[model samples]
Target: MSNEDIYLCIIGLCIVSYIPRVAPFLLLGKRQMPHAFELWLKYVPTSVFGALIFCSIFQTDSGVDFSFSNISMLAAIPVLAVAAKTHSLPYSIIVGLAAYWGLQQVM
Candidate 1:
């Protein structure tokens, strides 16, 4: 593709990506959410996190595996403990990564 064409493509991609992200804040900035909806929204992050962790630990390329050999399931134990005790996302993530890497090295 020509340089001008590539530039236009890049600009178009940026606009497309930016609009969906910015549109929510622009639309909701001045609005007051309902109490019930606000309460439900609070669980969204935890629910999403649980879903992602579930998929990562339980699912594999060959299919679902609940065996002891699953590194993600092994790593999740101490990660959950650290998260529960410290209640810090950053620390939990760091511990989880370290646990996963260590498990990889040992196994």
Candidate 2:
């Protein structure tokens, strides 16, 4: 595509991507969420994290791998422990990455 076309495409993508993110805050900033909804929102992050962790641990290019050799499942043990103990997302992520890297090195 031409340079102008590329520029237009980039700008279009930026607007498309930005709107969904900004629209929520723009629309909801002044409103107070219901207590039940707020309580439900609290679990969203944990649920997403759990889903991601399990997907990474259980799935591979070939198929599911639940054997002892699945390093991610093993690494998750310490990461889960750190997350449970500290309740700090950053710390948990750092420990999880370090554990994954160390396991990769060893196995």
Candidate 3:
């Protein structure tokens, strides 16, 4: 496309992408949510995170594997423990990487 056409397309794309992201802030910025709903929202991120990780940790090439031989499953134990005990993402990540790496070394 020509320069003007390309610029118009870029502007249109920016507007389309920006509206959805900005709409939430504009709509909710001045509002006060109920306390219970706000508290409920706290679990959203970790729930989503756990949903994503659960499949990778438990699933194998053949099927769902819950056995100790599953490295990701094994690694997740300490990762979860560190996350729960310390409530630190960096520590959990470090423990996860260390667990996965150490497991990779041995088994």
Candidate 4:
């Protein structure tokens, strides 16, 4: 295919994708969701967070190397512990990032 054809196809797909995602929110403004669906939505945050934490912990550049070399992961331990114990996102993030920066400097 020509460059023009590919560009047109991508634009068409993007427009198609945007309609389904945007249309419902635009048309149905703050409508009540079913109780069951609302309850299910409550789990989404934890599930997404768990997935992110799992990916961050298990994934690496070369392979599975859960070492102090990974400053983010190292910082995440204290972050998770403090967040869990205190239930404070702002404090956890601030302390975690500071620890990460400190570790990066040392390494």
Q: Which stretches of candidate 2 lie over 4 Å from their true place?
A: 1-31
lDDT of each residue in 1-107, candidate 1, tens digit only: 99999999999999999996996688786876688977997899899989998998889898998998989889999999999899999999999999999999999
Candidates' C-alpha lDDT: 0.92, 0.89, 0.91, 0.83
lDDT, ranked from best to worst: 1, 3, 2, 4
List, residue by residue over 1-107, the lDDT tens digit for candidate 2.
99999999999999999996896688696877688987997899889978897899888887889987899888989988998899999998899999999999999
RMSD of each: 4.8, 4.6, 6.2, 5.5
Q: By TM-score, how accurate is candidate 2?
A: 0.60
TM-score of 3: 0.64
Q: Write the per-residue lDDT of candidate 4 for residues 5-94, one digit (tens) a residue.
A: 999999999999999699668867667667897799789989999999878866787877677677667878888888989999899888
lDDT by residue for model 3 (31-78), tens:
877889779879998899888999989988999999989999999999
TM-score of each: 0.66, 0.60, 0.64, 0.58
Clashing pairs in 1: none
lDDT score for residue 8 of model 1: 100
lDDT of 1 at 89: 90
Ranking 1 against 2 by lDDT, winner = 1
Q: List the residue pairs that clash in candidate 2.
A: none
Candidate 1 lDDT score at position 2: 100
